[model samples]
Target: MTAETCENGPLRRFLTVSNKLAALGAIGVSIGFVIVIWVQNNHTRSLLYETELQDSIRMTEVIAAQLYGPLRWRKPSIAQDTYDSMITHRDLHVVAAVTLDRQGNVVTTYQQNSSQPFNFQELRLNAGADLRLDSTWTAELDGKLVVATPVTSHDGRKPAGTFVVAWSLAEIDRAMRAMFLRAAFITIVLFAAFTTLSLAIVHRQLSDPLTQLTQATTRIANGDKTFEIPCTDRRDEVGDMARALVTFRENVALIDRLTAEQQQQTLRLSNALEKEREYNALHREFVSMVSHEFRTPVAIIDGAAQRIERRVGKDTEDQLRERTGKIRSAVVRMIELIDSTLSVSRMEAGTIELEAAECDFAALLREVCQRQQEIAKHHKIDLTIADLPSRILIDAKRMDQVLTNLLSNAVKYAPDAPDIAVKAGTVGRNVVVSVRDRGLGIPEAEMPKLFEKFFRASTSAGIPGTGIGLHLVKHLVELHDGNITVDSTEGKGSTFSVTIPTRYGEADAAASAALSA
Candidate 1:
């Protein structure tokens, strides 16, 4: 090292590591002492000034009383004598007495050692006849206190003139200056002594504990978790830090065990992710196979039912025709199930599209209600559909499927419910379709996850469902820029509402016959 570097090395180390507690303590105490001294001095000065001002006001009152008898009787000599006597006080600067007549004109004036020219007329005008018996002082008048008092009769009935006094504050200011200097000197001496004592006490109390803590921390940083700070018996902040360091060392030892467990958990999570991927692949394959395999059989059964119905003669037995109708209805239900599964698959793949066209929402709902009544022969379907304007636009096929799923769910869940109500109406710019059933209502907790794929309510235990119906309904409705909401009470009933936008730009004509037909 060079000469300059050698000289600066110790200073550099000290600057980097020295605690500076002594210097900081000295500065804080000094500032606090100065502030206390300043506040006390200001308070003392205010009290002294107020006392002097009050004394001046009292002197004016005494002088005014003496002059009152002379001025009322129009005795100028007695009044002038009182004014001269009052102005002889050491601090008194000017004293003036003036008498005014009924017309407010000055009749007599006496002033001794006057500081400024006095206009009796102006003074009387400003201090009106009804002025209260209180003294007024202005601080901005060059450290002088000014008082205005009314000169009246012995009974204090009629005011003759005004008495004004001006008192100098030079002596008061000089005394305050001396007092402040003495207070400042004493405060400085006390601050120095207290700061030195505080520094010594702080060093005695804190330096050894802090030094031990630093050594313990250094050992911990160098991977010695067994090291302990030697100041745990202290009750102050240093002891608190020492205890915290002990806990930190304990935590450092525990971290190695946690790291090993974390590696095990990570390995387990990786295995679980692989199993989830396998399960998803299997689920997809099952859905695809069900859709492909069920469609052909359902089509074959439906075609056979149709052919039998067409060829049936009037002589055919009612029982045979009923069986054929049942067969066709069962096939239709199976087809609907397969189609719902396929729709969910398409939605997941993001390939489903809505074919928007002007549609009569009321007519479409009436048709869906009729079909549901036929399919659910044991239940009653009450349709309260309103005639919506033809300007509403939607995809007819998707909308039909949406209604079908809701009606099917209602029939399946409320098998013993005597009647289900299907209502359609126009609300603002949207067409709403509601299906309600007085059956086992869904629990409130299940409503949030009601539209999630493959999520069935606890009440749906033993009810046959693929759990894709409501999810599909939600997706199809949203595809047409619509929303669905469900309101259910635990043992009363449940209502599912679907809102679809009415895209009619003022078109109100029917595109087909009534759906009931």
Candidate 2:
């Protein structure tokens, strides 16, 4: 569709055809009626003006006849009295009159209400030597018509004088204006009545049925299959439209039902595909974990045993003991890996339970610090303990696992760094533990996924890890109803902080009070 079609509203879309037909017919009728009235009015006005002109000339001739005898005797008083009497009859529209001798010089002038003394130079006389008796000429001056008639002698042989009379056409103009107004009023009333009647008929015959069809079409567009089209019974184009709409509705409903079933199938397929992908990923992770983590310890133990067997007779007793010690250490390392994996499984199965007890928070942190220092012989583990609460409710075994993972990560990731700092303090009603290492710091982009399972930072790529240490630590901390946060800058250092509530709930409150006391 074009831009104009898109911009069309409901009235343009639905009512356009019927409305246009009604409007065109009304406008055509109105224009024709106005034209007819205007032409008739103009014709009537022209005829009325002609009649008025003839009447003025006739009146002038009659007055001139009355003045013929008076002008022959040069009696100005009798002509003046006649003019005064005519002006007094207001409907005559007479304004002034003048009498002139045969030489065209004014003999006398008479004016009604006001005087404009006659100027002989202004008189335009067209009388000829062969001018007929009772001959008349007319001219217009301002808004008045001036009629000039010749006064002849009783014998009809000689022109006696000229009689001029001025008649106003204002009355004629007023009558014409009234006639025009009446015609205009009648035309407007008839136009409005006929236009309204035509629109009403058009609305009933065309617009209404079309509107119902449009509504049904809209319902179908909106996915409503239940709305019935009522016009299908009539044998017309609208009925044809209604029947088509019913068919369209049925098709749409069928499509909707098929679409719903297809959607259900699609959802089932998606879920099954996702589950298969997850299973494949878990299998890969299990294989990688076992191969990478177990291979090193197994090889180390095997090599140590082989060396001990080789030194059976040639080496000193100390050498055999040292080789055996190496084998035992490798075995212990493998056992720890197995334990961590088992702990993960138990945690996932929701079978690992916490044994809550009151423990010395600072002492626990110090002991973990000493243990990390021994394990990381090359790196110093510093302890920075503030005045922590004397006791707090905790699951000691789980917390030890949490601290060990964090410290081990520090030593593993920051092997070349000089020291790791383990900090403990009380902030509000919570105990805070932090492990900081001055090593190759984590990248900013890697920080968000630091606690995610099987995810390792790019900086830790060369480091030996199953990638579950921090992930396990996070779960342990959260299981104790705590939160953990990390702050790190690239090439500087990284600090992981854990905050644990001092008391679990009201059950721990009495124990906490006794511990504080």
Candidate 3:
């Protein structure tokens, strides 16, 4: 054979038009099959991981519930028994279980296999497990799953401790590897058959039109909706596909327009909501100020009338003196109320200022206790003072309002429980005053909203209150650069404590100067 004929013999036959089309078809089918296999593998892996995670979480929650009683009662032996009973099952794959108290102290731990000990310190460092016992948490670290859940108190009000469980992921990993191998084997077997079928079916008759439609779809998928699809004129499946692409493009454009309009509407709604919130806040403040302003005058008038009615008879000198004293006390409270009302008004105007001055704190407490004691004649007010300065710089009238409201709440809530304790002391340059009442203590759920304006607790049902006292007290205390806290149990009692710095800038300077002289 000549050189030209030798070069064109088998190579030319293989590169014929029919053979070229077959090769292109086989390549396309192979790409499609690989994508399908990859997507299936990923989906299977995700489902397995999610199932294992959910199982770990459910098991941890069960263990926490079972150990609640043992943890709460401080019975480590019972806690161990609970853990062993629940975690000893081999199918559970529980490597270790740990219980931590509220202070993050490890109360008890159970290990499934002591020979292969689980390193909790490694888990803590690698899995970011710092014992956040407020909520349920789960993490995957180094082929292991960790699940932690809060063990709530008996009342289900708060978390008393945390229960943690670790699960071995070896079985899951092995199952995934087996699945992947099976998928690979099946894919290899099916690829040859699929390529042969695609090569036979995709000839010149369909390849050109399908390729054109594919390009048009790719452009549309890339967010170019203006590209005109081809081959719609022919009465064939390719023509039908082209028409469908046109319709899809139109739908996408319509959806885009509608999304833009919806976003505009959402923006308008958000602005309207913000305006409504501002108006509501201003309206509530106005209402609270008006209500308190009216209440003080009414109380003063009632006290004056009561004294007048009681002293109707021919009274002795001592009785006349006592009546006058009671009338003056009522007037003094009325003046204090006016001052507080002005303070609230200033606070609303955003210009509130504290009138801190040297005032006798012990005497003020005694006076407030006396007033409340007389008002709640059925209840006894016990006052205790320790290590308090003789005089501290404070807004005397505002402080009076603070103390009076606390004492009044104590009296009003604890109607049956007669003894209300008021304790005051100095701690590290701060004065702490606490009011304790054996009344219907606030529910745990309602504690967060205790100082919210117009928010009354569930326990305060049928009580004559506006739920503004504590809110106002908090605002006044904050103006003095102080904070207030409440400790209460549902049926036990409540303690409202206020802590304020004893030395203001001016007071500290004056004391320094006095010492220097």
Candidate 4:
């Protein structure tokens, strides 16, 4: 079949590919042009409105100045003459002008069209109850611009009366309408020319060659591999596509071989993923068993100590009482360690979340210090709290855990140090709580890995720790949309500071609510 007959056979019943592309291009260009024109029209109208408003105000000021003497001396005849002279100017387009005395009684008035009714009472109400003669006031009402200027005495200290003028806005409206019509006509002409040119170029450069390529591709799709693709010599994208098709036919066997190998690789990956999933299941089971196994004995030890203390009361030796107290303390410490381990596991499994609420932060800090002091009798914890908010939004239980951990670390790491300083205050829009201790400070080289999981500083060699306290601390702080930082000097001391915002943002609050739900 001839090329023209082939193009018209079935494709012409619908829009051809080239025709559709040209039409889409025309639509996009028209939308962009219309948007630009709309913005320009609005900007031009604003400029014109502002220009006319200023000119009206200036003209009213001049009329008020001329009428100052006439109203001051109570010469109604002269005031009428001044008002008439001002309104007679053709460019002013004054619809009605009125001069009123200090008590708002009309002294003299001028109306360009005597047929229209002018309400003096409405004008007085618009001027305001105070008369406000010290400055000018302007308003637009019923397609008219009204300006009221003060006519002051010769000394400019007291006002004698007010000069009010109303101008018609019809001229401005007419000008804007004319501008819109002209722009619409130009847009129509340009759009027609652009569409015609785009169609011509698309049909010449794209439609004919793509038609031949389409026929060749159809033949290959039907298993006619001996058919040749045309447009191979054009030195453009079309020629590249034609050459790529030839290579595709030759590599059919290679592609089939690679696909089979890929299937084998996918099967191997699936088996590895299954093995990893099984390992994770076993890990979770182990954590659950450890939690139940460790808590039972600790609870028994704590209960036995309490029973012995109650039985051996007045006749008990001081040493015996102290020994029982140590047993209970040890039980508490073990429980804390178990909880921390579970917390880390939950975090890794992505099941940990915050239960944020309004908390009394100051009371919470004082309680933490008191509990830490009870455990570490040798080291005194000195708390210095500044003016803090009455209530702060935070996860109170998790925050209590954070403070206890910090205090415990301070007492454990600082063997010889006698005191720990705890401070809480507000900085900018955040709340900052810092715990400082006089201990063997961290090595500077290991500072970068301080918050990494299972990382321990060299200075913590002799100290009893699982090396996950700071890492867990950092993670918990970040969950509250906060951060923890440290400052230390070797052989001196270390200060760990936590900073968090006073409240969560709307998006965070919504997410928290959804998670809770």
Candidate 5:
């Protein structure tokens, strides 16, 4: 509503929502892409395993056929070069034989890792026919593929039992290594190409538009609105989102500007209302204080004036003097209240200074107790005092004010209960003085701010108080380098404790001096 508020441009919209959307899209795509790769890798490995199985089986069949048939079951013989060739074969690592009787065994073995020797014995006895393969054993240092097969010798067309061969697993391991390396290399090359092309596509379709949006948002934050983002013709979600965002930003800026103006108007109204209320409160306090102070004195003056006017008709001269003395007492009480008000004002404005002196605290408490006892008797409130031997150095008048304010507050707050206590003792190198009252106590939550100016108890609404008593007490106590603490429970009672350090503790000062020596 003001010209000053209008000078600031449109309010800015937060664009973090856009970054979040992009991040969500990127995360979803990455997870899907990883799952696809894992499935593809599993399928490739399965295919490789099956291919190796078929190839190994076929090679076993071809190699086994070169051995004996059932007709040569008893005796077997083969040429040395023939045995040597089978032993040194590229794909096969061993050749060996065993009789159907468990004691007969012979082997043309490869010079490598050992094969399981029981195969020929076990296989010849178990199916008793064509044995295409025995088993493979892998080498420890370098994988050497080994297999065994039974062989037979043909002599005059007679039958012989078996011949067996042992072989290494080198070729199988080599093929597996090759397959894995190929898959890894191909996968890496394809992934690099895919990522590079995808990044370039994204740069074309997305990054440029997003960059423009970002710059426009920054300009908006800096209170600029003359520039605009170029709208694209693409009919995708991104294009729709860009259009929506531009519209949203336009609407939000207008609403925010209007809201700012409304806030300014509300602040001005609030300040004006606050000042008016403060003026009313000050006027009300002035009237109440002046009236309370002036009421009794005005009454006494009116009664005295009426008496003096009637003295010529009915009264003796001494009776007239007695009435005049009553008027003087009322005036003195009024003067005391006025002085209390003025002293509080001076304390608040930092115009009051202490007349500090090194006085015995014990002697001061004796005097305070003597004076308070007479007042307590009139109010029917018992005043108990104890532990007054502890001494401290402080301003006598200020210390007296602390005790007086606390006593008055307790009496005022607990008039019906009628019991009040004052206790003082040495706690470490400090003296602790406590005022305890059994009365309507303070709430726990209100205890902390009890010493703050103008704060009153929740239950004390009808009570006559200025709410400055505790505030003045706190300042006076602290001026003597003491701290005051309170503990209270609702409906029970309250205690106010003040602790001030000793001016000279005989034991402590002597210990410190001895240590220095």
Candidate 6:
């Protein structure tokens, strides 16, 4: 397997000068726009008020001119009435008057009934401060303007009176309102134009590039390696980003292709490794089985040959014959063990054929127990099967192998204990078979590896074993759609159980048929 490689990760930073400047510029422009609008509004208001004040002062001078001659001054009613009526017609709401005293007092005054009341007191006191219409009063009395002048009776002799005039500032107010409305409209139009231009610029330079990059990233995440981000011609910050994004996406595409190839390579390597491991296991088991099966017989044959050579006398002939019989038994044992191991291998390699004819498990257990008992007699151990009626469907040959393996192991591992129990029962819809031994039990740590090919328990380290017996048994059980497991304790004992589906009926007849195998 190839080791995974590492790479330096990219650091995405959020802080940048152009972004900061854009934020500051936006705030600055908004504030500046508001200031410009305020100044324009105030200037227009000032112009409107000043023009109205100037117009009022010119009209006041015209009224003062009427008092310059005796004819106009002596009978001042006609001139005063004419000017006052003209002022009224102009919708000025003005008061025209002449004073007959030198103390700037209101001696005689003319007023229209509809004009706003003005403060004559302040106008009389402040009239002579400066002559070019210096005294002008606001609506201090009651929403009115007061204009005052000192009169000398138009003869430079009769310090007649101070003229006091009152007028409404409604026209001045109207002019100011119109100016404000016009300025507001202009300000709104300019802001609208500026906002539209700013939005367009943002859309072209910022939004468009970002949207493209976002789409590219989405495509890349969805396993598309052919995503192409368009480049920007802008020279500002967005252009730098567009260049970086396109380059990064190209690199990611290359990495994606490499990663896919690497994944396939890794899968192939993993499969190759698993096949090699299985091959090694089977080869090792074959070599071990050959060694075990040949060693005992070879030793017996060599002993018999040497005994015949040593037994030249008449008393040694019987011993020589006995040794030859022992060697014959050893040879038969070797042949049986070799055949069993080879059968297991053929089954593992998928060459074993199962003739799934009807059979009985109870009778199968009896035959296996009788065989196990015969084998245990050689080691001075006892084997017994729990009583059960033969009533099931099974492959008798395959089940014999499973039971033989378990019984052989129990007797081999627990030679001194001698007691082995074979059991058969039904659990739910399945037939349950168990072989238990009161022997030198398996260690806790080695129990899980018992069904692994060529794996021997720690206690069986010095024992004669090819170690493929349990593995073959487990595989055979699974091929029958069954399960096998063991419960064991290190100094106590072990029980191996196999469960498979049970078919009802055909006990005695099926047992007789399987007995032929």
lDDT of 1 by residue, 1-517 (tens): 1112234586664442223666677778778888888898889889998898888778777777776777678777776666556555433645444554444556556555457676555455544555555655555444556666766666778776666555567778888889888887887787778767766676667776776787787777677776546888789999899999888878877985698799989999999999788767757755655565466547767776776777677425775667677677777787787788778879989999888787767778878888888878899999886757765788888999999989988988886786799888888888888999998889999999899876678887666676678989999988777899999987778999998778732333343334334
TM-scores of the candidates in the order shown: 0.44, 0.53, 0.45, 0.42, 0.42, 0.49
Show where candidate 4 strays beyond 4 Å: 1-320, 505-517
Model 3 lDDT on a 0 to 1 scale: 0.77
> Clashes per prediction?
1, 0, 0, 0, 31, 7
Q: Which lDDT values do the candidates have, in the order given?
A: 0.74, 0.78, 0.77, 0.80, 0.59, 0.66
lDDT, candidate 3, 56-139, per-residue tens: 888788778888889889999999888767877435788877788877677888788899877766544333345564445455
Instruction: Evaluate model 1: give its lDDT.
Output: 0.74
Candidate 2, which segments miss by more than 4 Å at Cα? 1-199, 208-212, 215-279, 313-325, 360-363, 388-391, 504-517
What global local distance difference test value does model 2 have?
A: 0.78
Ranking by lDDT: 4, 2, 3, 1, 6, 5
Say which prediction, candidate 1 or candidate 2, comes out ahead on lDDT. Answer: 2
lDDT of 6: 0.66
Q: Which candidate has the top score in TM-score?
A: 2
Which residue pairs come into collision in candidate 1? 391-504
Report the C-alpha displacement of residue 79, candidate 1, in angstroms: 99
Q: Is 1 or 2 the stronger prediction by TM-score?
A: 2
- Cα lDDT of candidate 5 equals 0.59
